[model samples]
Each structure stands twice: as structure tokens, then as C-alpha cells.
Target: MALSEQGRHALRHPPRWHWLLLLLILPIVAVSLLFEGWTTHEVDGARTRRACTSPIPRSADNGAPVLRVTGAGAETVQMPLRTAALTFDGGPDPVWTPRILDLLRARHAHATFFLYGTQAARHPDLVRRIHDEGHEIGSYTYTGGDLGSASAVRSQLELSLTQTALAGAASVNTRLLRLPHTTTADTMCGGEWSAARRASDDGYLLVAATARSRKPPLGVVRQYSHSALGYQEATKLLDDPEVGRFTTVTSGLGRPSLTAPASLLQRLQGNALIWTQSLGHRFARSMTWALGIAGGLGILRLVLLACLARVHVRRQRRHRSGAPWLREVNDPVTVLVPAHNEEAGVEATLRSLLASTHRDLQIIVIDDGSTDRTAEIARGVGDPRVTVVQQPNSGKPGALGTGLSYARCDIIVMIDADTVFEPDALHRLIQPLADPTIGAVSGNTKVGNRSRLLGRWQHLEYVLGFNLDRRMFEVLECMPTVPGAIGAFRRDALTAIGGISDDTLAEDTDLTMALWRVGRRVVYEERAVAWTEVPSTFSQLWRQRYRWCYGTLQSMWKHRHAVFEVGPAGRFGRRGLTYLALFQIVLPLFAPVVDVFALYGVCFGDTGQAVGVWLAFLAVQLVTAAYALRLDHERLRDLWALPLQLFVYRQLLYLVVIQSVVTALLGTRLKWHRMHRSGTANQHLLREPAPQPSGLASK
Candidate 1:
């Protein structure tokens, strides 16, 4: 195509990809949360935190526990006088570290506390408390891992991360080090000795406990876990007669402070890490709870629909047999078809109406300024009962008003030009109106071109979402809409509402709400079936749903005052409108939480739990879909597409809803999108068997 044609095509299909970008927010946050979870979470085994009793080489000082080894030579020192340097190893634990600090505070003694970085980040207060009391801090390799067993990279990360954690907690970096899973200089042997030499090369004073058999008067460096047993042993050592004084390693050795001030840049980075860890934890925790609520709400909706459908079937059957209000309906009904460039399926729609089992009909086709053969096609259909009325392009509501003026019968039926009714659909549809109280009846709308995957997904939605939902709505007497594909309305009710209107894009929904507000009843007739041509392409489906969603929002807002009215209108407002807001509007807006958290669980949480919950939700949906199919007399084979729909088609629908909501909030007008029909309305009509007569059996 030329550049001009490309430009025209671009204008025709304006970029809508940007609108769906909101859906990416959840996944991005989930990924960041998973990353934080991975980096911050550490699980050290029991053996890694245990004290090693291995023997050391004969080069270093036999009694001293502080070593500064360089090259092939090693040097060691002990505190002069009969004094011992008190040191606590493994952690500045939230529980035991605070208790140990209290014990030291009571005795007026100072000790070095080796902090596990993971614990330090979580309990920074404890690290600060250890430093603020004129004490010392040292690295226990973040998670208390045995450096002898760690790789070179692991060893470096363990030490550096501990430094960062200390920097964030107390704004200082420590050179004093205590290797976990070991006690004295004698135990720092083999690989432990190698790791010790590497640490000494980096200027870390390898601190260890005095030999087990040695006395504290010989200047001991204590080793202890931030645990109950360690607290007990440290208390005993503090009161020991062999120990003259309890002082920090630097103080006992008469050297400068072991901890140096951290740079501003390192402090900022450490603080950022702490902030992100906290954020990720809170976000994941909230998402989990919210996903559970969503799951529960979804299950509640399905359960209610299933139970209410049963009640509806029983009530309808009971009315048919014994209720005096219900009588056989043989009244003449007028059918209105609003056409706007629907040339593809106009003839099929007309012929289907003519072939209806209820033969006494007046069919009027209103041409809404179509720049196509829509008007000519209706006129060409040679039927005495068919009438074609031409009008200017004033939109769908204007065309419906024109057709309603031409309708001569007391009962009126409205349908789309791309819909074909079943032979007995019109008869069964009007039968519900025999009660005189029911002002409108909704018919089952099925997808005609259901051979493709997209069509199959829509077919499932019609059965479960629209048809099953209508059953519950009818039982509750809060039916929100009688779809335009097939619906019957009392002439008086239509006139009272000023006939079909352009007040909202969903004229059908607007009209139905008007009926409810006027003390008139609306109901669903599942036996009344109509096959309508649905959009075959994704672009067409998006545009079509965008209009429907936006229009429904408008109708809801327009009739929002009904909640304050009396009788039927209040019932619908409280029940129907509230239901739509919670389930349709609000729930859909938060539906992405399910997918986002499910991904997070799989990435950083329990895979089985996530998969189990997802599968459980899917199983519930499948069971509900099966029941809906049974009610509609549809085969179960179509359910194969239901699972796939959750991944792709369902996501598209929610995105359209979100975009439509944003557009509605902005008060932007949405004109009707003229769908490209394939004229396949009659294909399903011929291929599928006539719907079997439904009974009041427990479907």
C-alpha cells in the first residue's frame, strides 16, 4: 500500500495498544517483589551454625584468638593483664541479642556482636543498640554460613552484604570478623584456615574464642550464638573469677575502634535496599490476601448462579402448571431491525423472522443512513409482511425510534440486523409476557460463527456469563438488560420510556432500567434462542466490547437514582446495580491481582500452593460452565476452550473494561463501532440441531 493508504488505515484503526499498558503494572511489581524476595531471603542449615572443634596448625599463637596473617607468616595477640575480651557471635538477634545486651548493660561491660546481615536488615534496632552502648560490631557472614564450605564469590558476598547491612543499621563498617560454625583458633583448620588467611589479607581481624581448656585470665575472645544457651554461658563467663574485666576486643588490645564511618553513598544504597525489601514484603502479603478474596467472591457468584438457576426453573414450571396469571400468549408482535451497514446478514435476519413459528408478525427494517446496500437488501427481500423505512444517519437510537413508530402491534420485539432467531424463539419469548406484569423478556443470545477459537470462547461466555447470569437476575427480579439480539417489550412500557433512545450507547440496558423504574417487570426466557454473528477478529472484538462496557457504565450512572426509589426500581438498584458495580466493575478492575500474585508465588513462593489455588479456581469455573451448558442444552465439547479463554480472551475483556472505565471517567463520547460481519448468521442455524425442548429438570 502507498503511504497515503497506510495513513488512512492507521486513522481507521487508531493505536489502542497504549490503553492496555495498565495491565503490565501488576506483572512488573510482581517481578520486583520476586527479585527482592530472592535477594533478601536466606536459609542456613543447622550444621552451618554449629561450633566446629577441628584442630588448627602450629604456626599461630596457641592461646590467642585474634590473628592477622599475611603471606607465609602469621601474628597473634592477647589482651595484657588478666583480662578477657567479651564477644558474641552469630547474630544481633531480635530476641537473644537484646537480652545479651541487657545482661552486659547490667554488669557495665562492653562486647563485640557479630551480626548476620539478613537478621540485621530485619532487626536494625538491635544492631544500633549494640553499637550505641560503646560496644563493637563484626561480620558473621550475613546468614551465619560456614565460610569453609562457601565458594569464593559466596564468601565475598557474605562479607560485603554484612558490611552494607551494618552501614544501613549503624552507619559504620567493621573490620572485626567471626567465622560461623567454629569456636577457637585451634578449630580454624584446613579450609577454615584458608578462609581466615583470605579475610586477614582483606584486613579483617579473625576473632575466635580462647582454647576450651584455657582460662579467661589468659585473655579469651568469647564465641556464642544469639540463642538461649549462648546467653547462659555468657552470663557465667561475665561472673567468672578467672576473668578480671569484660571489655571490647579493641579496648582490650589497645587498638583503634574496629568500626569505621561509612560513606554517604554506601549508606544511601543500603537504605534503598532496606526500603525495597520492606515494600516487596508488604506488597506480596497484600496481594495474597486480595487474591484470596477475589477467589472467594468468584466462587460465591458461581454458587449463587447455580442455585438461583434451579429456583428459576422450578418457579417457571410451577407458573406454567398452576398460576392463574400466566395464560397462553397468541398476540401479534411487531419485530424491529435497526440496520447500519449490516448488509452481510440483513437478509438472513429478515428471513428468520418471517420463518418464525409465531406467524402473525409485522417486520419493520429501519435503515440508519448506511452507505451500503443495507436498505436495498431489505427492499429486495420480497415479503408482504416486511417493510423498509429509510432515514438519515442519526444513529441507532434514532433508527429504533423510527421502527417503533411503524410497529402496529401491542407487543414489540427488537433484534440486530446480524441476528437470526430460532423458529419457535418468538413464540416462547412472548409467552412470559402473558403474565401482564412482565414488561420485557430476554432471549438466549448465542454466537453463530462458533467454529473458530474466538467464536468458541464467546459461545462459552454467552452460555455462562450472559445466559446463566440472566437466570439468577430473573429469579431475583433484578434483570439488568434484555439484549437487543432478541428481546420483547410491552408497547406501553416502551412509550412510557419515550421508546428506544440514544441516551446511552447500550439502548437496550437503558430501556430495561427505565422499565424497572416504572414499576414494570423484566424477565429472561432461556428457551428463546437467537444466533448472532459475533466479531471474528481481535480488533473487531475489542472495539465492540469497548462500546458495550462504556455504554453499560453510562446506563448505570444514568439510573443510579433508582436505589432511592420505591418498589421494583429500588429492588433493581439495590440488587442489580450493586451486583454490577461489585462483580462487573470493581472486581474486574482488581482481577489482575490474581495473575500477578500467582506469578509471584510461582517465582518466589510455594509453587504447589499457587498452582493448586489456580487449578481449584479453574475447576470451579469449568463446573459452572458445564452446568450453564446443560441449562442451554449445549454440548460439553465446547468447554475445551474455556481454560484458554482465561489466559487470553479474558485478559482482553478486562483491559477493554479498564480502558472503557478510564474513557468514561474522562467523559469522552464513544460512538458505536460498526462491526464487520461475515454473514454467517444462518450457518449455525442450519448446522446445529434445533434446540431441544427444555424441561424443568434439575440441570
Candidate 2:
């Protein structure tokens, strides 16, 4: 019962919306990065400003006069002698802001507070306190980003978001603006001066400090940040006899107050800002948790693969070592090869079966309306034991059901039309059925064509992913899919489960689960190896995997109620289904989100940490894959493709899962995807002679 390669291209070619949705993610991420201040330039030449550096001086010697914009343009306002306006920048800090505010309150003096939109939105209570205490509030821009070097959109957002945050907090918008990094009025040069002019054009009063003097100066705005030095300087100024009065920026100039009632639009904008801020915070926190869970699950899977794989290897060795003494049953086994347009490999498949060491064999090749030489090829095999059955274009499941009806023996072995078994594969495969309790057994299926990179990748997946997982699944007592490539089933068990079911695309997985629900145990036989031709190209691979993934999903859902059942059914349901859901469905879905976050970190956040974490995960995977290859008796050199697979090949698998889920959610029916056969299954066999049978005589 080989996987049909027909209509594979259609299944693999995703809908336009799937690609458009993927393309749309880039722009959304770009916009998010921009808003997060990734695109903003720093204040001090190309370097980001860490904190407020030097305090603004307070004297006429500061060179250029600070411009106070009015309806008539701009005017330089000079303070009256000994009248200094104390100003604080970069706060509403949770700790320092409160200390500065308390200091000003105790001194009975007023100062203007320049607020960053981010800090303000985070602590609106502090913003209200600043306004209620009679301290003037001025915009320092959102995130305190340098507007001069920022993109136009970022610059506008920086200014407008500050206003929105201020409005949301205090129900007021400030007309006074303080350009970050500008100290004394004379410091406004180049980009700073340009930014100031732009601010003035927007009806903002550009405030800067006067030069420092030996004595407290009059009619100057003394700018400071909410820091220890700023607090100390403000305290010293308050005690200076030369500073006759301390007041807000506007009050010092005898102009209107900075605070005003926010308009309807401003209030609405403020509310929206608050909502977005909250949502952003929640999203960030959730992503952090998601990354943590993903890392944890990934590490856990690796550990299981490495540890349980060792156990599986030990168990296999012990079983094989005892096989010589075990009671041998030369049961007349019926091998069913279900075919559909597999003419290229049909001869090799029949020839392999004829060469099997198992005697008293009955081989039936069901050609399900293959519009090729599949039936002719089977009949030409010349083996008297081989029987060719022709039927209409029924699916693999139907063909398998039809073959089972014609089967003459109790022990039935089903092999894909393109699969070539090792000489002893059938013999070892049927050994497990000798145990009356074991109703079915899955054989080791390896990719036969490994000449190309894609083929090599699939080969690694067989050893590292599928084989390692089967080892763990066997130990866990939740063996899910006895692959159709080479699986042996008892006739009674197949009949009990109603033969092969066509209700799901994954007939193999569906039939396996049904057997479990009926209290039949399915096991794995690693010694029984079968070589099956895998899809060579990405398109063919996508189609095969997409159908496989979609079918598995359908099968899981069909048997979902088994989770609530008792005994082995519940055990398989809970353990197998849970593993599938978390690792298969949920993990793949979150993988793209993880990649997006990694990109965000590289572009806007912390690149070092992101790269470090990614490398660590890759290292763990490499180690686990190495162990899996060793367990499967594969070469370590093949592991070079493991890391590369993580980047490209793994993403394809993830997309397959995603598309399968999307299709299932939409209740869309998918046809069986068939791979074009190249008859590569016997290529390896042709190079090696068939091994002679041992212990038992060949009939």
C-alpha cells in the first residue's frame, strides 16, 4: 500500500491567501519594529543616549536665546534678573520622579517635568500627580528618540505619541517641547536646530537652558533630569539667595500655563494609546512564555530521543540475540502489494518479494486502475507464487481492502508497490505476529534514493526524526502509524477493525488507531528493513507530506473520543494524541512566531542573545541527531544536513502541518497525493548480494 503520488502538486501548491498571508507578515513586523523605536536614531552622534548627561546651564552667555512660539511666529524670552525657572527632564520615573517631586514640594518651589510617552503611559498616576502638584508638564517625545535623525514617520510618531500619553494621563496637552540632547540654548546646532524649527512650526515653544554662571542667574530655564545630581543641583538652587523665585516655564515668562484641557480627538487618541500600550505589554509577555515553552519542549524531546533511543537499541539487540532460540513458525504469509501508477518500481517490488527468505509465501499485487504497465509488470515477474489482481481506480485503502479479501493466509504482510525489502525483511517482520497478543508490527522504512541533497535530507529524517520517534513511541506504548511501506498485520485483527478504512487520508494511521481501540497491540520491528522511494523534488515532497499530515490530523480527530476510554485505548489516545498535538500541531504552528521574534530581536532587540539561544538549540539537535543515526546504524557524516534542514527543510514540514491544519479547519477534502515513481528502491539492492537464510531451511 504505497502512498499515491497522483494529484500531489495540487495538494502542495497552497492557496494564494496562504502565500499572501506570509508576505503580509513582513510588513506588519516592519511597522511594529518602527513603532518600537528600532528605526529611531540616537541623540549623541550615532550612539544611543543612555541617560541624561549634563544639566542645562542657566545664564545669558548660553549663546542663542530659547524661542517661545506664539501666533505671530517666535520670540526669544529673557528672564527677569535672579528669576530662574527650574525644569526636570526624562521622568515620571517610578523611583526618581517621586523623590524629585517630594523634594520640590518640601522646598515649596515649582519646576516643569518633561515626560517620555512610554514612561507616562506606564505610570499615569505619576503624571496626574505632576500636574496636580502645579508642576508644568512638557513633551520630551515618545521613547525620548532623537527626532533629527529618525525617519519622518518615526519622528512624527515620537512627538504625537507623547502628546497622546500626556493627554491620556492628565487630560491636557503641553505646547512646550524640549528637544532631547540639547543642553544650553547654544547647543542647538545642525539637526537639533532643524528639529527645533520644525517644532516651532507645529506651534511648540522650543525651550533650552541658559549658560551656567557662578551665581544663580535670573530669567533663565534651568533644565535637569530626575537623577541624583539633578536633585542635588535643584536643591542647591532653591537655597541660593540670588534665585529670588522658582516657577514653571510659562509662569516665569508671565505667559499662559502649559497645561490645558485635552480636546475630544486628543482624549480619544490618548485612550487608544493606552489600549495599544496594554496590548503590546501583554503580547510581549506572552511571547516570552511561548519561547520558554518551545525551548523546554524541544530540550525534552531531544533528551527523550537520546535516552529512549539507547533503550530501544538495547531492546532490539536483546530480541535479536534471542531470536535463534525462539519457537519458529513457518506460517504461510500473504504479502499484499497495492499499486497505483507505480510501473517504474513494480518489477523491483515483486522481485524483492520473490527473493525473500520467508517460504510458503503468497504474493498478491492489486493494481488499482493504474494507467501504466503496473499490472503487466507484476504478471511478468515469472514467480508462480505471485498473483496480479486488477481493479478500477480505487484509492490505496480500497485497493488494500480488496487485496485483503483475496489473501489466503492468517499472517498478512502489506508492502508498498515501490518498496523493496531486504532478503530477511519478511521473515523478521512476521516474527512478531508469532506473539498472539501482538496483532501488528511496523518495519523500518528507509529512503532508498539518497543521491541528491533532498534525498539525503529525507534519509536523515528517517534515521533522526521518524526512526528515533518510533523507538520512543514503542517504549511509551503509543505506536501510532505502522507505515504502509512494510507492515504485517493479523487477518483477525484487520477484520476486527473493519479492514482498511477510506474515511481518512492516512489509512495507515487510522487503521492503527482502530486496532488500538479494539485492544490490539501494535509493535515495531527494527530488524525488518524496507527501502521505499521517497519524493525527489520539493514539489513532490510537499504533496506527499501535506497529504500525510492532513491525513494524520483527520485520523487523530476521528479517534479523539478514545482519549476518554479506559485501558490501552485511553493510554494510546492520551499519550499518542497528546504528543502529536503538542509536538506536531502546536509546536509547528508556533515555530513561525518564534522565527519572527528572532528576527525582531536581531533587528531591534538583542542580537547576541538571540543568536546564542538559537545556536544552543541547534547544538542540542545535532547531538540528538547524532545519537539517532548511531542507533539506526547510519553514518555520522550524514549529520551535516541536520542543521541546514532546520532552516529550510524543517520550515517546509512546518508549512505542511500549517496547511493541513488550515485545510482541516475549513473542512476541505483533499485527494490522495501520489509521488512519481523512479524505481530507485532496488538501486541499493542491486549492488549487494542477497543474504542466505540461517537456522531455518528455505522451501
Please report the candidate that would top TM-score against the real structure: 1
Tell me, what's the RMSD of every candidate? 5.2, 5.6
**Per-residue C-alpha lDDT of model 2 across residues 1-699, encoded as one tens digit per residue:** 112222222344445576578668756544554454332331223234333233223332244345754343346766777888888988778888899889889989899888888778878899999999999999888877776665567667778888998888888998889888777775655555556667877778888887776246546778888888988988888888878889888888888886798998998889777666655555555776888888989999989878877777677666667872155767999999999998999898888888889978999999999898999989988889999999997889889999999999999999899998888889888887777777799998887787778998999989887878888888888888999999999999999988888878888998899989998888887778888899988999998998799888888888898899888888899999999999999999878877776666665556688788889998999888877666656668888887889889989998888888877775565688788988765675576543332321110
Error of 2 at 527 (Å): 1.7
Q: Residue 30 deviation, candidate 1, in Å?
A: 2.9
How well is each residue in 230-341 modelled by candidate 1, as lDDT tens digits?
9999898888987788888888889998899999987987787566666676777787788888889999999999999889888877776786236778899999999999
> What 10-residue stretch in candidate 1 is worst by lDDT?
1-10
Candidates in order, TM-scores: namely 0.88, 0.85
Deviation (Å) of 233 in candidate 2: 7.7
lDDT for model 1, on a 0 to 1 scale?
0.82
- The clash tally of candidate 2 reads 8
Q: Distance (Å) between predicted and true CA of 328, model 2?
A: 3.3
